[model samples]
Target: MVEINSLDENDVLFGVVASDRKNRWLGMHVDHDQTPPLPWWMSNPNQMPQWTNFLPGESNNHEYHGETRVQMRKPTGKWNDVPCDKKLKCICEININ
Candidate 1:
């Protein structure tokens, strides 16, 4: 995930990579940018942005495009099994110092 500064004066930007099944190249971009109280998308669902569909034993067939890939799974709890398209309330945090 790439962390960036938010365009807004009170926000901080966070970028993450997401992929589809078969480990194909999907896309990369910022998930959200907000201020203090850290966005729910950060911890609530525990859905850290990551590259998906990376099945083991298939790395030989995978191509490296110089993009950083991290393995992340959906959080198991109230947020588990929720559709990605569903919208939910979230918060954002900013460093004071």
Candidate 2:
């Protein structure tokens, strides 16, 4: 996950990645369970608001990446999708059950 366990690491990484102006890959990916697709994290039974979070004009827009997958831009933390092929830094989260 982009969120780090250590505060110092978080600060350093946040500054470095945020200034780069590139997408940070999320560990979660799209699953076509419904319209606009859903990321793995959202699909979890406990997760709510699964069908929302698409910014204005963002859902399935295909403007930048035809094979759209989830991405999050730094600072603003806006959720969006980009091409699956584009290489970017990754954010990971561990789910305990």
Candidate 3:
């Protein structure tokens, strides 16, 4: 497993792609804590949230290119469908008092 200790705010999480025992491309996000911004296409045209930050490209292409995005929100559970070959980006945050 790849471990990133220091990540910037602009970094995008990467996921891997691999065939399971059934020979299926498991395309899923492994890290749920990092909630990448939803794409504009997926968002509502009439209503937009203040925190909307959709990436320029599509999630499928990101996976095809061997790259995944780390979401801002923390994950609640693990994704069993996530492939082994996908790569994810992470952001490291620190508070200064």
Candidate topping TM-score: 2
Local distance difference test values of all predictions, in order: 0.25, 0.54, 0.28
Best by lDDT: 2
Which of the two, 1 or 2, has more TM-score? 2
lDDT of 2 by residue, 16-74 (tens): 55788765764445555457564554334344333334446654637535544666667
Q: What is the TM-score of each candidate against the true structure?
A: 0.19, 0.51, 0.21
Q: Model 1: runs farther than 4 Å from truth? A: 1-81
lDDT of 1 at 55: 31
lDDT of 3: 0.28
* Candidate 2 whole-model C-alpha lDDT, 0 to 1: 0.54
**lDDT by residue (tens digit), candidate 1, 12-40:** 11122122211111222222222211122
- Candidate 3 deviant stretches above 4 angstroms: 1-49, 55-85
Task: Give me the overall lDDT of model 1.
Answer: 0.25
lDDT of 3 by residue, 28-87 (tens): 233322355232211232332333223333333334443333233222111222234544
Rank candidates, lDDT, best first.
2, 3, 1
lDDT of 1 at 92: 31
Q: What TM-score does model 1 achieve against the real structure?
A: 0.19
Error of 2 at 18 (Å): 2.5
Q: Model 2 misses residue 30 by how many Å?
A: 2.7
